[model samples]
Target chain A: MNPEMLTKWLIRWGGTAAMIAVLTAGAGDGVAQESVAVRAALVTGTLPLDDPNAAAWNNAAPAVFPMSPQVHWPERIQQVTVQDLTVRALHDGTQIAVLLEYADPTEDPDDAAAIEFMVGDKKAHFAHGQPMLLVEGGPVNIWYWKSKDNKGVDLWAKGFGTLRPHEHQDVKAKGEYANGKWRVVFSRSLATDHPDEDAQITPGQFINIAFAVWDGRKDDAGQVIEKGSQKAVSSWWYFRAEPPPDYSGYVYAGVAAVLALGFQFVLIRKLKEGQSA
Target chain B: MGRALIRPIVIMGAMYAFLKFVLPNIPGSAEIPASLIILYLLLTLSGIIIFETLSAESKDAFWGPMQRFLTGENIGGLQPLRYGILVLFPVLVGWQTYNATAPSDSPPAENRVIHPAPPGEYTGLANPVPKTPENIMQGKGFYAAFCSPCHGANFDGKGPAARGYNPPPANFADPTTIAMLQESYLFWRIKKGGVGLPIEGMPWKSAMPRWELELPDEWIWKIIMGEYDGAHQTPRTWE
Candidate 1:
């Protein structure tokens, strides 16, 4: 075909392909960000607390986040047993539950998992909160679950060495270990009475959250190999109790589309006038 | 309506896809930031447009189809296509605008000096440790013990502790990073780490620990040599 005919033919099909590509470009997971938000899907019924394999969990999407060794402090662990964490969350308007799952080769007594949320409006460094001397944000509220205790503890931390239990222990958790994997579930009320100590989970807002896991590998004498800061950790990710459907985004986009069409029409008219002149 | 008009747009799109998607996934490639991508595309578009429109015949070949399409001229069966483009163009623009204006939970992009100037005393300083094979081997061991936790054993910066930190660890394997820097600058950065950066390295976001207190000066020099060797790059010369 001649170049003119080829151009016309190409334009006919290529234009359609390009349009489709442009429309779907947003869907591509191009590059991995440092951390992506873990959404807490809204559900109509009660959350499946203490149940990792509950039917209700199927409604929520799981986000697998990479975990790294804790190398910030002097007692840091260079190697990490847990390389990634599978997290799922659900909220039933009043209560929120999070399910944490990871692979563990051994079931020593020291196996534990914890999730931390930024307490108040300020933002702290992801590696536990900022140091107490360099505290630029509010404290971090941690919900810790241990395999031995088979329960969760509500704790608060200002920095690395300042972890302490909250006055009101409102968080609850349960763990199940089988076939070299540990599935743990932590649940708490969306809003707590203690505003100063606990992180309030409000709908339609994003909050910073982090995770840590201890594999509980023990020495020959039965001493825990992973202790204190020697564990796998994740940086601050986002947690949001998804709000009700908002149509304002669509409305704005529709208006903008109409305006853009009008601009194109105006541009074509001007071009025609210039051609005639 | 010849290939002249459509070629530039197609090239731009292909370049964009390559830079935004294909390049980052390559084993040793570094990601080009969004701002840099836009600048590059703009330059490429201008260059192609200049070349295509330089001659009268080529100019007509390039602009004829576009003008005809706009005026609904010789295009017979493509009338529906013109309308299709009219509708799709607005939607694409609107979608892009919406994304740009949307409020996000992710932190705002930060600007920091990738390689700030070293202190006066440190600028002229030299690596005391020789770059012998044995020294390089020792440096490799030191790097594995200290740097590999965050910088990665492969020097790709995907170390076990690298994921969580924003302004993630530097991939020394990328030519744009270690290969472009002076040995003395690397020495200064190693000794001081993140806390030692000047004001331009704002937010002090680097998680690099100061090795001055822990490792001796010779060890730091050795680590630098090992880093260059492992990344298969050479330090920039003073000349």
Candidate 2:
């Protein structure tokens, strides 16, 4: 075949294939719809390691989410104990840090506070266990922080009561209580190769995240200290990671489309004589 | 055969892409900006028009068989079909052009009249705390924590999350918005929230969550004081 004929066939088939690929990849059906949307603002400057008062976090956007009581067996509570949760996240390419601030009537002596955040593949289902909150059949990473402990425990679990401590501790947390409120900061690397940790975060991509708060208040009896009970469990939500500095996905899409059209037009002109074929 | 398949594939594929990838990604729900859809539709329609103009004879090759089947065994039966196509084609083009160029702030059918009335219990209620500079500053902090995500830092209804909500959060700056409503009404709305909205019109679809138990009464009142003072706009009742 001549160069003209070869080019025309290539354009015709190539354009059709390209369009199909773009449509299928972009249409993510199983991804959970955002019940709550959190925007993790991009910060280029360095953040204070292991400290909450980082200058880089000053300009971060704050997201406030409602904390409802965990109404399930062994931990059923009719009334919501906690009121609201305000969160802010900042990333400077190397690390992603989250700051959470919420009001607590009084600080519990035994356990100050705890936070559990789940992040994994978009297709993964977030299951709230009747006895505990955990996903079924694996791939849920839980970061548990307690005020009394020097460091927090990272765990990987699949189902109810299946949680096992992670091989290595990856998440660092700090908690400060003052003026009837607790402010906590959690930080970790943006991406990691750890088997138990699914830390793949990219700009413009949505990831499912939910939070559980544990208030360590005790009842009248000293034996009844709910040392680490989840007082509130939030519904599944999503946060789109800050897009890269050169975020031009739309521009690329536009240019690719225009080139596809130009290629189609050229092929049509060249194959006009073969139209009857 | 190859030429015939290519155009349909491209057209349908492009439409699929627009509906799937483009439409869902556009910021708002009920307030979907028509400009993007309009542009895509116009471009696809123009592509068809260009192709039809170029392949006048071949145009019949695709449409002729279907047209014949639709008007089978009837003399001059295709006249209505041709006339119908001729009339509807321009109407579709004109509608798309209007939507593409129309102002986004234009109210929806249900937004024609959305005046909310406070309940009897809440009618006479007012902020008990005095609005000192410190109180106003504290109110600003509460507003930033709870309301700023949707209502915006300046209460302009252009917050980051505001783009995702329909009937985007009320703009306190607008004369017809909080400026016209009393503090009692604002209090009731914040406490009861979207669920408390009158069951009439599109008000029921509001995404505003009830903050009654979540936010303290002091903070709620403070937010009201802070918003009006910070924005330099007076609340309706204070006048």
lDDT of each: 0.83, 0.62
lDDT of 1 by residue, B1-239 (tens): 56887788799999999999999999999999999999999999889889988999988888878888887777899889988998899999889877766656453445678887778877767788877999999999999999998999999998878975656789999999989988898998888776566656642345677678688999999999999999999998877
* Residue clash pairs of candidate 2: none
- Which candidate achieves the best TM-score against the true structure? 1
| Cα-based lDDT at residue B57, candidate 2 | 78
lDDT per residue (tens digit) for residues A1-277 in model 1 = 9999999999999999999998787677775443467788888876898787788877788888888777765687777789889899999889899999899998877899999998887665555564422224567899999989999999998766889998889999999998999989999999999878899999888777889999898879978877888888886667888876666667777889999999999988987886788
Candidate 2 versus the native: TM-score?
A: 0.44
For B5-113, candidate 2 gives per-residue lDDT tens digits of 4676688688857675776778784333568667767787777756765776767765544444333323266667655654455455545555554433221234323
Best by lDDT: 1
What DockQ class does candidate 1 belong to?
incorrect
The segments of candidate 1 whose C-alpha lies over 4 angstroms from its true place after superposition are: A1-35, A132-138, A193-196, A250-277, B1-138, B152-154, B158-168, B192-207, B229-232, B237-239
lDDT of 2 by residue, A85-188 (tens): 77788777777777877887868644443344444532232332111111122356666677667355776655446667877878888877888787778777
